[model samples]
Target chain A: MWFKYIMVKLVLQNVSTLRGIVGVLNDILKEAKFKMTNDGVHMSATDPAKIIMIVLDIPRTGFDEYICEKEVELGVSIEEFYNVLKRANKGETVQIENIDNKLKIITTGKVTREFVLPLIESIEDAPKITTGEFSAKIVAETDIIVTAIDDASIISDELVFKATQGNFEVAAKSEFHSTNLNLIKDKLIDLNVKESAQSTFSIDYLRRIFATSKLAPVAELNISTNHIGKFSFSATDMFRMYFLLAPRTTD
Target chain B: MWFKYIMVKLVLQNVSTLRGIVGVLNDILKEAKFKMTNDGVHMSATDPAKIIMIVLDIPRTGFDEYICEKEVELGVSIEEFYNVLKRANKGETVQIENIDNKLKIITTGKVTREFVLPLIESIEDAPKITTGEFSAKIVAETDIIVTAIDDASIISDELVFKATQGNFEVAAKSEFHSTNLNLIKDKLIDLNVKESAQSTFSIDYLRRIFATSKLAPVAELNISTNHIGKFSFSATDMFRMYFLLAPRTTD
Candidate 1:
């Protein structure tokens, strides 16, 4: 039998943050693997198409009450979890429990609702990613990137990120239309570049990464010319999420 | 030549009202026929499936500036019109002009956007609807009906509306679940029933009609047992919309 005792119980005062996190994760991957430890909860997954990888960490302090008896990993359907969270009001308190290989979620609002989702076996382990020497790094408002991506998406499928000593620009162009957005040093929280670097990435993946904009106010971007890029979005002290994407060559 | 000069030019201080009107119409019909006159703009259509008919009247006072040189009827793709409106900020002014068999929409906000959509010939004339004497009438908050319809939709494809001397109730039941909502006389603006009346209607049509809830505060419901029903939603003096639906007989 796969039945087991209750291993993890978490209570959240507000479900908005969790909703935001799950919403972004669902956009990147259909299923997610959640690791619960004494320290906090962690989840990471790569898109099935192998274009983007996302890592998420939520500290114990982020939850009102988090209890984990032992280190355990559970597999959850990101889409189903997100749909259940949609039922919760922003101010509602959410309670989650793991029992007998099933995950139970309870939300307290004008009316209390409960949902039980069966747990599946975890997928293959996440790949170990190594960092590459980046030539440019910039920290800017999340809205700046999100809005630019949205605007560019209207015209083209690919967007270019150009970084220099003084400015970071996102531009996209098609045969008939083009959009260019510039973020100067004055608008960035931090900017560092040894030399100018430009790279293009798929706008589809960028949009999924930017879905976290509602949860965080700022995002740190690290890019190398014609290589992979990383985006780290931080939401105050609540949580931190990282996204890594491969760049498309100019061939 | 049909092309002579601009026939209608309208500037709206806010595009939200127009968005609301189009959103609901799009759900009912794909193409919409709009009739422009000196008094205001009018649109009426019956669903392609012939299940429901809707009529919209927006007065001249609703617009910041309204001009009409001659009466003209234009056919527009509701889905395309909605996509253009989506670009306008809720608080932004939208200027619309009909010129050379095309509708030009300009929205001014933090940025200005212009979209030109070609107008097709009117599809067909709106049928004249003669409503029978209704035995039950109730005026209630739009949100109440919208919420009840949404809740009932979760369990059944049809919902029954029952009106007694002092209470208006919306109820739906399936094999496994049921929902009942009651709006008493005290909670309604007005309620009048010569005798008890009950009728069932398709939730699909109800949802499309209630999509205009955000545009109006109150809806006047008129119905007779197992007959046709009319829902009249009015937003202050800006616009008035009427939805007529044929009830589904239980037999």
Candidate 2:
């Protein structure tokens, strides 16, 4: 007789990246599915209205200790997971263990905290988002984008992103007020505009995307004419988050 | 011809203390009455339910510049005042000038911001709380008290304070859980108990009182057996806040 033993445990030295990723996911989706394998962990979810989809991938090298004998899929409530992760200090290590049907989270800081979260049913058929060629690709500091989104949110519900020659402008207009933030080529790390593309999106979605600004110093933007826009935020070699947002037309 | 001139203006080195005091008042009461005299500024308010009363006093010496030709009383919405002050940086100097019917607040920091708040009719006869002799008096670090209150709040709706010869204890007991925090003589600056006394008060009131912990380092507690309790949180000689809470019977 032959038997195979299965062990699934992951320990991360710093929880800041995980916390930042979970914070953004909780804002976009209610429930998220995590796939843990020998390689690493992958999670993705779409908003209820299907306006946005988020994908998170963390390689095995991201964690201090990653042990997996067999692949396992865990369904979790993102909000609850974020709340539990919040209990860990910025520099503290977090140890996660698969216990029967619950996830055991052990955070070591000034005091060790143990939290057990019940697993939910994973979404078997999550919508797959395809990456296509874009007309404009811009790379800028995350802080600049976050600040622009925040300023635009105060004036209108919709924000327009326009990339022209050597300049990327974020603008919002309403009956009462209007705000415009212009990022010149000198300020941005990279700017590529094939034919000058502009798209309008809901400020609500953009604000949620900026929630992960702490995870990375900069964000790479891939903007298509009028279909979809993608923002990729990556931190060193620890984690990478992708936010896909659907464009809105001003009718 | 005889003319009388009245001018009331106060400039503080930092708005943090003022912000903390206003934050506590806004939670307890909707409107507050501020009286400015040669000595300083005094404000007090009672909760809508009359379960708690808060008093705030800032001496003239606390302000960088205090100019008051005649005593003036201004009625303000505590929430609005707090919201305006929130725009000021932590260490930014705030200049408050009574201009006709509005209070002008100028904050000097990275950017100068000016906000005008309309003054309303002052509450002429605000209820005055008399400080009575208490059976037990204890002084301890504000952080310890605040943490204990936060911990107790998670377990019960009421917290009991008991002071014996050399120990001060804060405990919360509920049907589901109980939490006790004891501060011995070594940990406290002063602990006096003429006779052992115990009192229970609503955790809701205690939590609001602790919101001002950032304004002071130590908090002085005056406990009168089963009657009322007063907590005085003072920051150096700049400001002092007093919170009087009505006790509840466990039975």
Candidate 3:
């Protein structure tokens, strides 16, 4: 593979939320860790419930010319960098350099305004989310399964992904609302599951996938009963993200 | 052209403010009137002192497919029609039409929400702006001039556009601020001096141009002693924008 970007960056919850306009980027990237040594930026930011790591590595090289090594405590100005790169498109040429404590990003097309991301202490104090035993991996069997389930969850605030003896179903119900989205894996991918486990999570968090639709080629989700779960996708590039949500009390 | 549209709306202001978003639109497309016909709607919102205009136009072809004819009103929600065509981009395919009391708008892309503008009756009354003595025509050559001034009237809340012989200059001065932005032109387009007048107006009203950088491709402006001016920009489309202001007592 041709080396493009040499550095990496980790995106956090609060910094991204505070800066994410139109709310598109927040949903797609979510909780992830990005490591950058000489390519892009190696930094992290978060709030109470999410942890995100962002890596700013280009598909090409020349980043080492400007990369600077600093302790993790020297938080990267995610907002400024994002705004600078925000003017750029996917394949456009962008050169990022650390000049005099300021990150300078230059895009190829119409010269966009210089963005300045202020360096501040990383707000890394989020709620500790830890889950115990979780076992269930059902490769997306068909397109219909993901679509139906995703749609059904739209109206309800929570969703239940259950893996039983031979059937795997994602469902939701309410007085005036009810949705049953199912998937039969015998005809599709490899399915491995023993005991039945049904857990509910906020659809608000689950909606993150739709935001990254352009880049999400594959999705691997890990779930449980009490703590947060993980949802990851690999599109043109590899992306790993997680969401830790506390389950609601049963009635 | 192929016809289509969901709804067409018109909003007018009777209460004139010192600074409003729509004022900028008048500066761009000088004498252009917002046309709300069967196909779609087109109007520019500007600030009162004439800086920019937020010009929004949704064509009928951008919608799916629908058509009908009826009297258009304001504020009422044509939800179904609005929802369908809300995602229409600047140059998207639209098909909007009226059927009975319902409006049908078919949009090419997915829509999250719709926008509706209020009508003339519902909006607060604005100043009654009328045609002035120099409201005639100007010779193309000598009529257009704009200059970005430096620290002259830095503290003064007003600027003066004085016409002498055949030249015009914008000047401002005060203890805290003294600056002038002047533009000179004299080859052609002639100005009819309404008794050779000068007026002082607030710069705050001119800041709204940030929203509208498009509509005012070519425009004509008017100035008087009382700080009341009329700005017009037109070709095939016609519009007359009025700006009312009290002259600053900068003695």
Q: Which pairs clash (backbone N, Cα, C closer than 3 Å) in model 1?
A: none
Interface RMSD of each: 6.1, 7.0, 12.7
Question: Each model's TM-score?
Answer: 0.56, 0.55, 0.46
**What does the lDDT read for residue B220 in candidate 3?**
51
Which lDDT tens digits does candidate 3 get at residues B193-228? 546667665554433322222334444556666545
Greater lDDT among 1 and 3 belongs to: 1
Better of 2 and 3 by lDDT: 2
lDDT of 2 by residue, A73-167 (tens): 88888887887777566776888887666676776654344566777865665787786788899999999999999999887888889999899
User: Model 2, B138: alpha-carbon shift in Å?
Assistant: 18
| Predicted candidate 3 versus true structure: per-residue lDDT over A23-105, tens digit per residue | 33444333323334543333233432443322222221323233435422334433334444444444445554444433344
Sort all candidates by lDDT, best to worst: 1, 2, 3
Worst 10 residues of 1 chain A by lDDT: A173-182
CA lDDT of each candidate? 0.86, 0.83, 0.42
Interface RMSD of 3: 12.7
Task: Locate the minimum summed-lDDT window of 10 residues in model 3 chain A.
Answer: A13-22
